[model samples]
Target: MTIASTLRLSLYGVALSAISTLGLIGCSNSSTDTAATTENSSAADAEKPAKSIAITQIVEHPSLDDMRRGIIDELADNGYVEGQNLTVNFQSAQGNTATAGQIAKQFAGDNPDAIVAISTPSAQSIVAATTTIPIIYTAVSDPLGAKLINEDGKPFQSNLTGLSSQLPLEPQLDLLQQIKPEMKTIGYVYSPGEANSVSLRDSLKQALPARDLTLLDIPANRPTDIGMATRSLQGRADIIYTSFDNNVASAFEAMTQAANELKLPIVASDEFSVKRGAAAALGVNDYDFGRTTGKMVYRVLNGEAINNIEPAVMNDLTLYISPKHAKTQGVSLPAELLKNGINVDEQAQSTDNK
Candidate 1:
């Protein structure tokens, strides 16, 4: 039509192109700013990493629950106070291994500042879930047998370190003898799925025979089946012994009930078990074991490399007798043993309040 109209159309086209260019430039700037902000946020989180911890346990037993409390208390003593400066996330597998694995995967994805695994199953799950995030485990016996550590005595992952609950065997055996002076066979109820229990069972097999005592280990595949397993040991064993097996500990009350029906006394490996119903327990203080684990976690969070901190074992053992529980289990704790050991029913009330 008209040259002037064509010129106007060209100008409009040019203006549209210019506006589009400006819009593209603004979008680019916005994207760059967002990326930079994200990077800065991540770096800030890295700098203040002692603020969060994710914890998981295979079961909700007194020993493991106490250990978790000990971990938090230890961290608080070192300045990472929960609800003030620290955030703690905890999950319990409730004696299910599949749940343990699911919790481990969640913790790995959440990428917390640190992870605390309370039992062998939970520890194995988390150790398999991630290799970069720092992990500190506690209440595990036979770390090597659990495959958390290699034969070289080093953690399998550079990011892994922990505390072992392995206690001296002599004290445990002595307590058993005190409970049953003429004991010929020591019956043990354990979880075959747990590495710690298997390790302890093997050790007892060798250690007991040296003292002319034999071990009768019955496997309870599930927590609910523990009482039935205990009843199975009726004619075979003189007294029942239990280690730090997560499954057995979770259902200890049931086992004690069955044992009471059979007039069988139970000798447990930890003090918390004594509180539940075991006639006596001689093992490491689970809370102290957990506090020591917190120290390792604190070191890792405080910028210490995890590989530099080796896995440790707490060996200090204490005897705890529940005469009330003993009476129910048809065993009388020796007078000398009662004088030497802590009465869990009386003295443990103070410790439990903490």
Candidate 2:
């Protein structure tokens, strides 16, 4: 082989080695650029905010109003602030069932993340309106009997769960018996459309018989009918029992006035009614119930599956009595009853005073 031919072959080998080195460098640069791009994409995804949720409420009553406040407060505490990360649409039925149903249907159409129904009628209407949306109810009585849930307090095939306001009937009846041992016949005024009232009436009927007493039920369909129904029981009953019937409660003044005229003491199922004119009440603190319901809302909005959470009962029973009504009706509450009284008006004379 000649020296010149050998030098040409060495030059060709050097050229191939240089080309391979350049190719490797170019591939390394390409890989670096791809890694940087992937990292940027991940950072962008992390910076994006989560989805916004909508919460709808059905009514504007005091108990329900408190519940709404609780939910809003809870949402804010859990990083879901209204007008920022969340949207809240609150509507009121004004004690009208038809309007409640309409509001529920409209709410369902909006496809909110969750719905919080306040009362039995509102919950029932919402349940009827949508089976897909999740419903969390408060201040409802006997969800099982109302067909809102199953016997085990599980969601009713749909995504419905909530807290119940089923205050114990036996306690209230027993308290009434304690306050007025001689009282054999008690009058109960309720609204026919209210499921809570119906359940309470049935419970009272069942409870009173065991105490050797009779419950005189007066069913009123509207607020106007309450006065007449209550008046019908004027002389027949020694005392009157008022449930948390919205119809009866809205016109509480009328019932109290009638009872005052007849000199009949009032026993109620809520503190608000007791403040109005009921001599005493063995009931639940509705505001506390609201706070509890708010916690449940927090769990659901935090992505916790509601199916795993059982329905809760707000069983904090409190006894309240009005000294004004007690004195006006000539009914003396026991010392134990007065101990649990929330607001006792010792100075404010009863309207029954001449």
Candidate 3:
């Protein structure tokens, strides 16, 4: 071979060796960067602590049940999905106030990220049990009178914040008046021990007189007594009126049965009650009330201070009428009110079958 050809071949060999060495170094750097990124991701996942919350309700009524469902569904929508990054513990007091108190103590001992109390009795129990655990209560009426907050509805110096179902009494009365035109006595069936029920009853006493009507107060301490309490109002009361009481709500079927037997119409303060069997309701939807509560909980989970959130009252009212229930109770719905009603349930199942 020529000498010039041999020199060129040697130069080509050196260039190929340098290119192979650069390729190997690039692969090593890429692999190291990938491994470091994986490690960093793992460390970040490990540093994130799992969030948890406990929910307690006073009873298993449909209204309260819908509230619970709304809360869970809303939380899932906010990215705190259950069984993923969030842990939700739920307990129902089963219409027993003593059980509610015990459940509150148990949750307080667990010291979860938050405690959601539904209904006034459940909220009061949790409030008495813990002063530090953040509590977001729903379906409570008259939070100010219940001492959950000040008159201004601020959770100042307290870890209490929630949505109130405190419906306006006068509007509800006006709805009854519009239905019966001659309703002289407004009969109320509720549990006397419930703070919300008692508050509502007191408010009704003042509001009833303005419409030239009297208030008949019937007390049912437990679910079993609902029928008897409602029966007591049969002859004396011109019509039946129900407040948002957990105990009475648990056995609302009994109230419906009593009303049916007496052929007396019922007007409830909660839309769910109307859907269940009451003749009508001019009130708040407890599920929406709970969604508002879940939003508050999401804010707290996102590190917003609980004390900074002022207590809220539901402003929107939904008018629901049940033509089926009205017919069963010997009442006729006003066409004008029916036109404005958000919905009319004509096929609601009877309380006996439910």
2 versus 3: better TM-score goes to: 3
Give one digit per residue, the lDDT tens place, for model 2 in 34-136.
Answer: 8786565444433333434344443344545665676666555444556655677777787789998888888888887778888788888888998877778
The sequence of per-residue lDDT tens digits that candidate 3 reaches over residues 1-354 is: 211122112111212222122111101111256878656544443344568999999988888999888887666556566785689999999988899999999999999989999888899899999999899998887788778888655663478888876665656777788778887888888898898888888888887776788989988888999999889886798898887888878899999999999988998867778877888887777777677678778777757788877676664667778878888998888886677664556334344457
Better-scoring candidate (lDDT), 1 or 3: 1
Which has the better TM-score: candidate 1, or candidate 3? 3
Per-prediction TM-score to the true structure, in the order listed: 0.83, 0.78, 0.83
* Distance from true location, Cα of 347 in model 2, Å: 13
The clash numbers for all candidates, in the given order, read 0, 0, 0
Best by lDDT: 1
> Which candidate's TM-score is highest?
3
Residue 96, model 2, lDDT: 84
The better candidate by TM-score, 1 or 2, is 1
Q: Where in model 3 is the C-alpha error above 4 Å?
A: 1-49, 346-354
- lDDT of each model, Cα atoms only? 0.79, 0.70, 0.77
The local lDDT score (0 to 100) that residue 162 gets in candidate 2 is 84
Q: What residue runs in model 2 are displaced by over 4 Å at the alpha carbon?
A: 1-60, 344-354
